[model samples]
Target: MNDQPILLILMIAVGLYTFNLWREDCKNAQAGKPSPSALPGATPASAKACIIAALGALVILIAETWGELRLGLSDQQSKITVLFGIYTLIAAFIEELIFRGFIVIENKGRALRWAGVAMASVLFAALHPFLWKWEDGVFAWTFSAKGWFSTAAVFASSLWFYTVRFASFNPHRSLLPCIVAHATKNMGVILIKGAQGFVVGLF
Candidate 1:
């Protein structure tokens, strides 16, 4: 069974859910309640936070994928890099909005907040196939070393994103920093992978 269709369907579902969250935020704003926008505008401080978060993500990615850094893409893979880049940016924004903006924001109280973060981080990690691959009929009970490492890395990254989003200076809890940081991380991965592909092609 081709997983691409399942993945595409999952992406659409996530996109719709994110859109609903944005709509709710708009409604809450109109009612004079505190709510974060899914696509909030970035302030200078948020921009700085974004840079910090992106750099942090890059460090984590580099550490996690160090051995695979030299792996290259095929000609077909190179051709799809642009499309993947766009998908990464949009997907990162939606994931951040859902996990940090909606999930974390909705759960009130310190205990609930931590619980929310933990649950969201786990869900975020699960969404990445690198961490847990689905086999012929089900997800594998056993993970490769890479899968375990990726899961840990993704969980940590999700926590980092939540921290940045929640710590925004904006009174309305803007998620711009999270979005920017996530996009930057995705772009960095794409660029690095593309460079690797070019180098391999030269040899």
Candidate 2:
């Protein structure tokens, strides 16, 4: 689980995706395309907005479902925080770079926008898998389309839609909520593990 190969792959993917998205904009600006910045608003840059977003995120924290997904405590219980901590930190930044920074900001087309969302969903779920036993070799279903699709759906609804970038659909113009929402969600899970003893593992 601590292998560097996956991390290296992630790094390469992010760089390639960003270059693909922004290269056209770069070339176009050189030619004559209009320039428009597309960075999302993070917390603190907007005090009131940040507070409101944080509050909203707290609401999501209360509703988080990941804790329920855990069955019981294992040796991994104590280290749950470490695993999710890295997951939250790395995923928060990397996913943003891939989705909003590159995909949405670059294309802004409806179809491409959804494609970006779908791509992010798949990647995110692939990172987090359900419980596995050592003797099984590989969870046969893990490589199946149904398995991937279900996990992707869960990831999309929870992490992407219910948590991050709700504005991608409608009714939301602010990005602060997304950031705060993610933070609160991660923190809430941490609290649950401490208080009630729900544990998550990394394969």
**How close is each model in CA RMSD to the real structure?**
6.4, 8.3
The numbered model that scores best in lDDT is 1
Deviation in Å, model 1, residue 16 alpha carbon: 11
Worst 10 residues of 2 by lDDT: 67-76
What lDDT would each prediction earn against the true structure? 0.63, 0.47
Error of 1 at 91 (Å): 0.4
Best by TM-score: 1
Per-residue alpha-carbon lDDT of model 1 for 1-203, expressed as tens digits?
A: 12254565566567767656665665565466734532442222345666777777777777656644443212322222344455566688788766776576354787788788888899899888764446666866555655566667788889878777666343445566677678777777677667756322211
Pairs of residues at least 3 apart in sequence or in different chains that clash in candidate 1 = none
Per-residue lDDT over 105-150 for candidate 2, one digit per residue giving the tens place of the 0 to 100 score: 3347766666666676656566556422233365433354334433
TM-score of each: 0.65, 0.47
Model 2 misplaced regions, further than 4 Å: 1-45, 48-61, 64-87, 105-108, 131-154, 157-177, 199-203
Clashes of each: 0, 0
How many clashes does the backbone of model 1 have? Answer: 0
The deviation in Å at residue 7 for candidate 1 is: 8.8
